[model samples]
Target: MEDVKDYEIKALKKQIFISNLKAWIIGIILVAEIIFIGSFFSKMGTFGEESLSENKVAVVRYNQEVTEEFTTTIMERMDEIKEDETYKSVLFIMGSPGGSPTASEELSEYLKAFQKEMPITMYVDSIAASGGYYIASSIKPLIANKNAIVGSIGVIMPHYNFGQLAKTVGS
Candidate 1:
C-alpha cells in the first residue's frame, strides 16, 4: 500500500511539471510573436508616441483599400500630425486599386485640410487608380514613377439587370 501511494505521487508530480513547462513555452512563443509583429508594423511607418514627439517627417502609408475604417484611421493620424509641431511635413505614400467613393472623398477632404496646415508630398509608387488617384490629386506636388499606373480616374455606378440576362439565357 505504501509503495503504490509513492508511485501515484511521483506520476502526479511529473504531470504537473510537464504542464508547467508547456505553458512557459507557449507564453514565450506568444511574446516573441507580438514583438515580431510590432516591429514589422513599426517599419511600415506606424509611428509610436515617442516617434511622433521627435523632429521627423510624418509618413502616412495608404496602401490598403480605402474604406470608412481606414479613412477614419487616416483622419486620426492627420489630426496627430497637425497637433505635433515637430512634424515639418508629411509624405503620403500610396498604392491602391481604389475602393469606396465616399471613403475616398472623405480622405481627400481630410488631406486637403491637412495640406493647408503643412506641406504634403504625395508619392504614388505603384498603382493608384480611380478613387486612389482622386485622393492623391487633391494634394500638391504629387509624384509618380515612370512605370507607376496613376490613371483610370473616374466613378461608375453600374446597374446590372441580371434578371433579363437569366431570362435570355433560359435559366
Candidate 2:
C-alpha cells in the first residue's frame, strides 16, 4: 500500500511536470508571436513615414493600372508635396497605354485638383493613348515628342474568338 501510494504520487508529479512544460512552451510561442507582430508593424510604419518624407515626383509608367490603391498613393503624395514647402511643383511623367476608364477619370480629377494648388506638368515620353491621353490633356502644358504616338482618343475592347479552334479540337 505504501509503495502503491508512492507510485501514484510520482505519476501525479510527472503529469504536473508535463502540463507545466506545455504551458511554458505555449507561453513562449505567444510571446514570440506578439514580438514578431509588433516588430513587423513598427517596420511598416517606419517605411510609410520614410516614403512620405522622401522627395517624390509621381510617375505613372508602363501599363500601370490606376486602381484605388494607386489613387490613394497619389493623394498621399500630393499631401506630402503640399506639406513640403521646398518641393516646388508636381511633374507627372506619364508613360502608359491607359487602363480602366473610371480609374483614369479619378486620377485625372485628382491631378486637376493638385494643379489648381500648384504647377502640374505632364511629360509624355511614349504612347499616352486613350485614357492616358485623357489625363494628359487635362494638364495645362502637355509636352510630347513629335514622333510619339499621342492620341488614340478612343476606347477599344479587345476580344479573341476561339470558337472555331475549339470546334476543330472536339470540345
Model 1: lDDT equals: 0.87
Estimate the Cα RMSD of every predicted model relative to the unseen true structure.
10.2, 12.1
Q: What local lDDT score does residue 36 receive in model 2, on the 0 to 100 scale?
A: 89
lDDT of all predictions: 0.87, 0.75
Clashes of each: 0, 0
Once fitted onto the true fold, the runs of candidate 1 whose alpha carbons sit more than 4 angstroms away are 1-55, 160-171
Residue 68 accuracy (lDDT) in model 1: 89
The digit string of per-residue lDDT tens for model 2 on 36-83 reads 887776655543332432444444343454466666776787788777
Which residue pairs show backbone clashes in model 1?
none
lDDT of 2 at 2: 100
The best candidate by TM-score is 1
